[model samples]
Target: MDRRRTLRQRLATQRLSAAPLPRAADVVRLLACVQSQERDHAFFSLGLRSRDTTYAAVRAAYDRGAFLRTHILRPTWHFVLPDDVRWILAATSPRVLRAMSYRHAQVGLDDPAHVTRSLDALGELLRGRAFLTRREIGAAFGERPGLPSAGEQLGHLLLLAELEGLVCSGPMKGVHHSYALLDEVVPPAPALGRDEALARLAHRFFAGHGPASLKDLARWASVTQADARAGVAATLAATPGALEEVEIDGITHWFDPSLPRRTTAGRAAHLLPVYDEAVLTYPAVNFPAAPGHPTGGAVDPFWEPVIVDETNAGLWRRTVGKDAVAVETRLATGLDHEQRALVLEAARRLADFLGRELDYREVTGGPAADDAKARRAAIG
Candidate 1:
């Protein structure tokens, strides 16, 4: 396939299939591919939306025997389906653990003996409890014998326990955080040998996010290029499809040819949380913003509500007092009358999604605040 044609095809696939599809269950299953708790709020962005939305998705996946709360990828809490988690962890966890070894040393957990002691203490404290927030768990540890500074120590201990598959964040309890034992929560899936595990994960990655090269896989998985190439080779050897090469700016990249194409419908308005995987996982070459965006080099990876037109023309936020939603557009040049109308329509769609009457102001001729009063009047 021609390089430009292939690149276009990949972008098309991502625009269509990258987001949650027909069923919420399928979305929850795909969440396994990218979720990571160690990176802080990224986990919440994965599937932990409102209490109702998150719980429904989790319960559905759990009932179907999908895995929950394991150190699958990026050495953090990812809710992999039971069938997929074992091989994913086997293929991906070693690299993440190795990367974290230096962090372990820095946190005064360099010795395996020390790590084991911490895990034992934690496991004992959490045995029968359904869940405890990190703070509550730390307080419990403070009362234990031979443990000091349990609050600070708890963080390191939890990291070790999570990496070892001993504990994970359980279902949300009305916004109060909680954690549970893995064995009690998710039964083990059948195990795969190392080679089989690696091959399986690579194939899943390509199937889920195909038309991607080894380097893209490496960056997403946080593994070395060598390991990524080996994984890709193993996957391609087993699969029937041919590997196609594409060149961008004179650099060659490999991708699967059968990847889906982008659909233009229903993609204009998105309330992407901060660090949504759609924006985070793919290569930068795929979704280049309009030239001269104020946020500069690539879009700021935050949960600002984005308005996508021919390009990412503006960003929006909600706050108290003034208009519930505020919009700021970094136009390459000022929007003509038609483009401005489209932008307002996009803003209205965003307001509908949030279930609030949207009050919006266009940042024309200057910063948005300069014309805030007029913009609100226009919306009214």
Candidate 2:
């Protein structure tokens, strides 16, 4: 069979079976398409981490061991499935860590022995504790002499512990955050030897985000292209049925052959937070926007409430006050009446979701227009 036909059939099967699932559940299911493990990285996908509806689905996955917290992909915390985390982390983390090695040295944290000791001490403080706000945890370290300022030392320590799977955030505490020791919160993952881990990760990556080139996997996993290619070969050898190659604009891209063939009707309008995976996973060109409408692709990452049409549209931001939520849209071009109405409706939905009132505004052209970009530049 032609590979494209097989891919279409697989998608058809999924669409037929997707009939009864709720919107939030459906979104969560799609998340599994890109990530085999679910550790719900709170920072990147704020809505998945914070919204009640999405968070519930994510937590359920976590509780079931379908998702776990591991340092994977970008060397940042990612919510991956328990079965997949070990291999993904093993395959990817070293490269990411290596890139940061120089930064560690400049910051006086390059000593492996010192980093390990700091992790052990931090873990002991967090074990069995329900949750400690980052501040509280920092205080624990600050009390110790010869330690860098809590702000400085604790930041690096937490990153190390996260890489080691020693801890993760617990449920939200009224806008205050808490952390729990990983050993206490989740079961131990079986250890995998290096090559086995690398092969498994590569296979899952293609399975979830395949039709991707080896270079794409390498970029996404922050590993060398050689390692990524090794993973690609291993995955194809193990599961030939799962691979499919598609030619887009004369370029062959490998992706999961089984992804759904048709777009579901009534895909809900979402007010995705900054760094939502839907926007972050693919390049900016993948998002659908009004011709010339400023797309989130051009926006920096700190902005919130990215307004997505059926496909990723452009980015939006909202500020909530006691009376109403003020929405600001920065588009590449002016929106027509219908597009404006649609954007307002999205804002209203967001306000309702957050239990606030709605207000709308737009800004186009000039440096001040790019809210996210401006904020990031300011910080830099």
Model 2 bad stretches (over 4 Å): 1-71, 193-196, 206-211, 267-272, 294-297, 300-313, 332-336, 362-379
Worst 10 residues of 2 by lDDT: 9-18
- Which whole-number lDDT from 0 to 100 does residue 99 have in model 2? 82
Tens-digit lDDT track of model 1 for 1-380: 44345444543444432333444335445434645453223333434222223434444444444445555566555556645655666667777778888877876777777777767877776788557777777777677765534544557667667766687656555545467776666667778887766666666665555556677778777667787777667777877564555665565566556645554454344444454555556564444444444453345322243434434444544442333555444443433566656657765644443345677764432234544676577679
Candidate 2 C-alpha lDDT tens digits along 31-119: 43233222233421323323343444544544444445444567665555444544555666677777877877877787777787777
Give the distance in Å from residue 201's predicted Cα in candidate 2 to where it truly belongs.
3.1
Candidates' C-alpha lDDT: 0.55, 0.55
Per-model TM against the reference: 0.75, 0.76
